[model samples]
Target: MTPVWKKTPKPTELIDRVTQAFRLAFGYEPTAVYSAPGRVNLLGEHIDYSGGTVLPFALPQRTYLAVTPRQDRLLRAVTAQGDAGASASSSPREIELGAIAPGAVEGWLAYVAGVPWAMAQEGLVSRDELPGADIAIDSSVPLGAGLSSSAALECSTALAFDAFAAANTGREPLSASDTGRTQLAIACIRAENEIAGANTGGMDQSISLRAHQGSVLAIDCRDFSTRPLTVDVDRAGLALLVMDTRAHHNLSDGQYAKRRAACDFTADTLGLTTLRDYFESTPTLAEAHQLVARWEEQVTAGMVDLPPQTDLPTARAALRHALTEIARVEECLALFSTAETTEQTWAQLGDLLNASHDSLRDDYRVSCDELDLAVNAARAAGALGARMTGGGFGGSAIALVSQELVPTVAEAVASAYERAGFNHPEFLLASPAASAAQDR
Candidate 1:
């Protein structure tokens, strides 16, 4: 078992390391550098594509991109972390900017090559007009943790390209304004979906580009509008502990795609634009149950078709998770706004977190044994609330605990993993941090 805790490197340290890697790889200094943080979804899971609102905050762990524009049309990329799994090739990968397209690049380089292509598709820039760059990638965000490390890579690359475009046209940096950040996020999402072949929703990219320090960003996937709620964990005497099960998950696996497809199928069967169209405002847990019941009634009445690929029970289960998770997100927002968090409020928040995990584990069917153990152990150790964050399956779970009990909760989870003969879980203390931006 490895160490129980791993610290995310500070900005200065990461910046310096990336700079050195850039120089060593390209044999010249990078003109500029940009960084984007991986994200943790505090609440609301697997409903973004269904147009549900989610609460996510940026992590201190980030991916950094260092670039120097090239006069020619060839784009080249390299990474400092050879086994980061960001790319298949440990050496630099190169492709003509004009040749970049969907499936043009494979493996990790697809993420690197897709940004310029997506920017062109979005009309933010033309592929022929885009400046090629020698790029270096470095990151502290743990791979396969469901912490949105892929988004961090896409977003950092997007910001770097955005800066390149601004400088080429003698315009102000597009990353400077909220609207511009939204555009950059859009480009990143397209790169992930069309180029990388990952069917991710906008939640990850939106939070990576738009999140603020000490606040969680509430995102409406329907419109991609955002509201930041201040979270003072220190003031509330709480610590947000993220425990990585060391059980890696790949979203490109059919698991994530199947869930998204089921949700889409359910919404289409109901004749609603999205499951969220069924709710004008946030629903109560009772109302969420009612919504599920309504779906069952409709199914029994033969109002919708159940394709062989998606059975009635699976559709209903998916809907149940989406509706209930939406409610949990709303509850969190209300709690954050009403007053400073006291012990009672913290407990209430914990209950919602627990319920969210249950829905994901039972109905959504995404929790693995490792995730369940991590959550159960943290709760037994006196965490206010514990749930698996991100896309579930096999990634990380977060526990809300009293600040003073952080060590105790971490040790308990480690002990449980040890007893189960599972990999020793790694831990991180999560705080709301700044969104993606230029580092230097």
Candidate 2:
């Protein structure tokens, strides 16, 4: 059987439903409703925290938060659930604004309450001036699918706080200017890292806040600077298909933290600020191989300081993946700089995607069995290239296929999963989507 396909909800309907839910939960009208898109990283994986560049575009599926500032410093929040087969509805939680802090809130609620705390702690707003809010969230972004669902929630909350700050403090809206959006993105990052305890990098928040329709954002992780590249695959008869493996993936778990630690250890031992710095110096695939060989020699000679639980091989693999992934992003950027793309241009891009997945699976050790199966199956079914696109313990894979072959590719993946006795996957055709903004 062909797997199920998900569709993006109409924005007006989503806004209306969430607004009604907000009125029922808080007994008042919301000041405004804001939304942010989840993102799919087209290329570059597991290299953001290493200060490497990445390319990602926004997903139409979004999280909508209807919020209103309260007169007093108390946060009341609720969410609509059970559509994805979880709880029917989340129990409303009330939190004192003063009590907001890192690790103070737990479960999914931290993603909401931590925004105000992060904004104040990061100096985006004053703690005394911060307003308490009542939020009701309804999202279509699949949770734990490696689709940046948590970032979507945090970014939408960030926009809500910015709107209130603009009204109360006489400051301009942060989402109105690129500079302001960057600041908002930083606050969201802090919320995820400190308040939510995810230990993730800034890619998801950056793309969610800074992306533009009909384009992908190329983010320089070192400075978080971005440039939009218009890659119109539809004109070339290609479609980007997202394959949700239905395998559980959670970044807040310790597994993600360990990988970040390994990357940091590799940087410290190599005497570089980050692996990206080294990539800048040695920017070719050949140079990356040579550098890895030299590092292996040093490890064997007992000249490198190895962390207790991390060995030379793991560190070497992590460094290699970061450096090579950076180079692939550079190549992809160069390809997009052309005035028009051809079949050959896409073939080259496809080659890079295939290589990226191989590196993540073999070198970074992130891809799981389900992810591997989906990617391989898609490629076998005439996909130009396919790769796992998220945090990768078990998440979604992306396939680049001709528009006409989409159904064929989807069926092939479904058959593969059934033969393996894995959960049937879901599918979506991802298009470039807008950044976070007030919907009402």
CA-lDDT, candidates in order? 0.87, 0.88
Q: Please give, for residues 1-440, the per-residue lDDT of candidate 1 as tens digits.
A: 33378777788999998888888887889989999999999898988998889999999999998898899988999886554454423468899988888878786778888988898899997654588899988899998898998999999998888878887888887799999999889988899888888888899999999999989898999899999887677788888999999898888777888888888877888788888887756667788889889888988899876534877788788889999888888788888896557777788889999999999999999999999999999999899999999987798999999989998889999989999999999999999989998899
In model 1, residue pairs whose N, Cα or C atoms come closer than 3 Å (at least 3 residues apart or on different chains), thus clashing, are: none
* lDDT for residue 163 in candidate 2, whole number 0-100: 83
RMSD of 2: 1.6
Candidates' RMSD to native: 1.8, 1.6
| Candidate whose lDDT is highest | 2
How far is 376's C-alpha from truth in model 1 (Å)?
0.5
RMSD over all Cα atoms, model 1: 1.8
**Model 2: per-residue lDDT, tens digit, 9-123?**
7999899989998988878898789999999999989889988888999999999999988889989888885324375364578899899888788877888888888888888
Residue 85 lDDT, candidate 2, scale 0-100: 31
